[model samples]
Target: MLQNPIGISRLVLASSSPRRRELVASLDLSLPVSVLSPDVDESVLPAWTPDETVRQLSAAKAQAALELLKGRSGAEGDELLALDAVIIAADTVVALDGEVLGKPLDEKDAAAMLMKLQGKRHEVYTGIAVLQSGNGQMHVESKKTIVTMKPFTEEKARKYAATGEPLDKAGAYGIQGLGATLVEEIEGCYFNVVGLPLSLLADMLEPYGIQAI
Candidate 1:
């Protein structure tokens, strides 16, 4: 038989992002780990710096999951318990010229963001937080990667955006999906551009006694 030394009975992931979930799943954690999406207000805070934004949002997500565990029911028992938890949360953003490029409001907005990014350089930031409620140990950090997109005609941009993939993605693009063709090169963590910096996430989680298989 195999074993894990993380001293964790379950790992909780608190985000609705499919990308994050997939990245965490790749860890091949023990089958007892549970994934949960916490409801959080994602609106950007006024005057909040980019680095702080990622940290705050991730911490908030962890806090939300903590509260949920404090109040919600579990299959084991009717009453709430700490459940030896190690919760993970993260957020990603794309920015250019100090302006945060959130999910495009519409096709027009997507096109506008793409225009500024095509043939130009922009940064992708991901904030990660790991909290162990059973012992109150917490770790939080952020990672950045710069991605450059190849120049293309408006017709090409329009065609890609029409697939509806850009609308849900930050900076109006996803380097991991159909958007891969647009990437000329990247200067940092490739997984960060994919929406989760796996190596960095591993480094952060290591201190908390959790090891991804």
Candidate 2:
């Protein structure tokens, strides 16, 4: 592989979401990409709005991952810590009429969320935080996407929930998967609803000397 001339040696994603990992890989950056699941409390305060919720969570995840990298001791850990790595962290949430709906606690909960969202328009917010390990500088931003769900019955929502795809996704649906059938249209970055907004992420990465183009 060719070296990254911009001085960023590796890209570390501080998330466990497969959707996020896949989106980052799609960028095809010249540098090596690493995945590190950040361990942090994700409880949202009752006072936090959708925008604030995701932004704080993404920043927390980035900070947790940075601390994790610094605490490692093995050969692999040492190698990773030595590189000038750029850490990408993100958090996403779905809001309907300003009520934030996160991942479902159970299949029933998933169906309920879908029922509330069907035939209605909601907003998806994704907060992205980019941290440079060498300098410890971080940039945080968020993007919003308006999504309209197709009209469907409670039974239909239940059936979709039974498929198990909605359990792990914010808004109880994954626009990139079988959940696409639930979305009638979206007014913003399509990838934002999928979990990460590629265009927004690219812009955030640019200041760190990393360009997807």
Candidate 3:
């Protein structure tokens, strides 16, 4: 069994995002994390609220990772199940009005998203899930952060999109990256806009015997 500096047995992060990993590491938990990107469809359900959409997606990712761990627990005579572990999953989206903005489909789409967001206040929502591998007990929650963007011209939006910085981000911008220049102010947890809300994560982890500090 793998052990971390703090003596936590194992922690799995159900995501492929480097940003999320970095954010987790910043907690200074002194734990080694295994990252697994669960294979799950992220199609938004028409009947779900934007917040619900992200929460459900985050829970689904945790569930998928938990199932995978269970499947591997006894494979090849390995005692994977013997290790005490936990899985963490998160999903984020940008919402303008009632519409959720996901990763852009193309350069044009990214440009359009940025153009629409210019000089507007939008909400960033991130859902987090933490599951204990022992009993499948999990906690899930969603957070919202309001962000105001600088008024920008369509030409600038197109130019920024052409740089490809916004292609993989839900809101066609990353507050921690080149997109910082486009943001006028942030009205909530800054980390939530970045992807993972640290305080929220710490709270969800409490039931699993993990503390951020």
Whose lDDT is greatest here? 2
Query: Candidate 1: where are CA atoms >4 Å away?
Result: 1-6, 74-81
Provide the clashing-pair count of each candidate structure. Answer: 0, 0, 0
lDDT of 1 at 181: 94
Q: Give the range where candidate 2 is weakest over 10 consecutive residues by summed lDDT.
A: 73-82
lDDT of 1 by residue, 1-213 (tens): 112235566678887778888888897765455677889888878788777787888888888887776566454463424657778888888988777777898888888788889999888988888887665567788999989899988888888888888998888888889899999999999988877799988877666557775
**What TM-score do all the candidates reach, one by one?**
0.89, 0.93, 0.92
lDDT of 3 by residue, 1-213 (tens): 122223346789999889999999998776678788889889878888889999999999999998877777777454554257789999999999989999999989999999889999999999998777776777789999999999999999998899898988898998999999999999999999999999998877665557887
Local distance difference test values of all predictions, in order: 0.80, 0.89, 0.86
CA lDDT, candidate 2, residue 107? 97
Better of 2 and 3 by lDDT: 2
Model 2 misplacement above 4 A: 1-6, 73-83
Best-performing candidate as measured by TM-score: 2
Across 64-177, the per-residue lDDT of candidate 2 in tens digits comes to 888877666244557545347888999999999989999999999999999999999999999999888766778899999999999999999999999999999998999988
